[model samples]
Target: MTNISNAKIAILATNGFEKSELFEPRKQLMEAGAKVTIISLESGSIKSWDQKDWGESIGVDMIVDNASESDFDALVLPGGQMNPDILRAEDKAVDFVKAFFDAGKPIAAICHAPWLLIEADLVQDRNVTGYKSIKTDLINAGARFEDSEVVVDNGLITSRHPGDLDAFSAKIIEEVKEGIHKRMQKAA
Candidate 1:
């Protein structure tokens, strides 16, 4: 496993996030010694959406309105049908995501989370993958869509669904450890 002991990673999400997609990656990153912070739209706890029902509530460590990309080494976007949908519509959320890209920070997203990437206008000319339901949306946004478990383009890591959590987490850790990517730096 990659050691990201000094990396400050931010997991940005809101209520209705896919339970496994959020928790699993956070768990794995923390286990690998990375400092993982849950940055949400609010200050209180946010509920998770399990497979078919509401899941646990995770405390928000920071508010997106107050977060700065300079303070984090990487970002993780967990997906659920409602989570990304809600986040994509929030100007603050979309701007926060764009800052990470602007700074060339590594970003890992799964399932519908890429919707925010689309909202931030960061997917153009990039190779990415997400939940099958959003495949067309991704392609329409100019992203080279893939159906693989995990697709890494520059510093952007994307996966199809919760089932790809292992690979997603691993790639995030690896990318974070590798630091900034040249492509991302150029874009920035």
Candidate 2:
């Protein structure tokens, strides 16, 4: 297991986030000793989307508007059709994502969460993967899209869907342990 005992991770999501995508990674990271915080568009709790219905509610640790990239070592974006679609439209949320990229911090986006990367304009020329529905959007954003369980490009890690959670969580732990990437620094 990768040890990240000193690392601080920020999970950005809102209502409609894929339940497993957010929970699994958060669970694994915490188990590995990382301090994980849920950052969202609002205070209080955000509901999850599980399969065809609403899932459990996850408490928000901090609002996006109040979050600072410097406060966390890495970022995680959980996907669900509604989650990313809604986040992509929030200017503060988009800017919050951009700040993480600008600081060259490691970012992990699973499934539809790549939409936020596209919104932040950080996918150009990078290799990434996401749920099938956003393949074109990722390609148009200049990302070399792949159909894989997980793809780690620089400090950005992405995966296809919930089934890829194991690989996705592993890669996130690996990257966070590796720290900032040179590619991200150059892009920043």
Candidate 3:
């Protein structure tokens, strides 16, 4: 079983988020005993984009302006064409992502979601993976792009597409647990 019970994760997304990317990871993380919070641009609910139709509605636990990096243990960015596209346009959301990286916390970004990482300038000199189309942009931003189901560099975890959910979620969970173990060892 997963052992991240004390881990608190922040999932950043907004309207147009890929349906499964947000839901699947949230479900798995919660099941693993991690406390997950959905942080978005606004309160209320955010919509999602399923394969060909509109998907589920996820509640926002807190707005970007009110969120603090100290409250969470990790960050998860879910991708959909419009989701990250819209989020990158918001200065607060962009800064939120930047803060998480600045804190040296584990981050998981999949699909087109890595756009925020690019916007936050956190992709520099790191190895990552994302949708095929954005691979060029990530490379240009100083990320060593790789074509893989899942790529974990340090504490940054990334995946190619929605099809890689299994690998992506697994890697994120492992990294989170590993991070906890490392932190505990340091404290010891």
Q: What is each predicted model's overall lDDT from 0 to 1?
A: 0.93, 0.93, 0.89
Candidate achieving higher lDDT, 1 or 3: 1
Q: Give me the overall lDDT of model 3.
A: 0.89
Which scores higher on lDDT, 1 or 2?
Answer: 2
Candidate 1, overall lDDT? 0.93
**lDDT computed for candidate 2:** 0.93
For 1-188, candidate 1 gives per-residue lDDT tens digits of 66779789999999999999999999999999989999999999999999999999999999998899899999999999999999999999999898888777898989999999999998999999999999999999999999999999989999999889999999999889889776643255
What is the clash count for each candidate, in the order shown?
0, 0, 0
Report the candidate with higher TM-score, 1 versus 3.
Answer: 1
lDDT of 3 by residue, 1-188 (tens): 57679889999999999999999999889888899999999899999999888999989999999999889988999999999999999999999887777677888999999999899887877889999999999999989999999998778899989899988888888988776322111122
Per-model TM against the reference: 0.96, 0.96, 0.93
Q: Which ten residues in a row have the lowest lDDT in candidate 1?
A: 179-188
In model 3, the runs with Cα more than 4 Å from the true position are 180-188
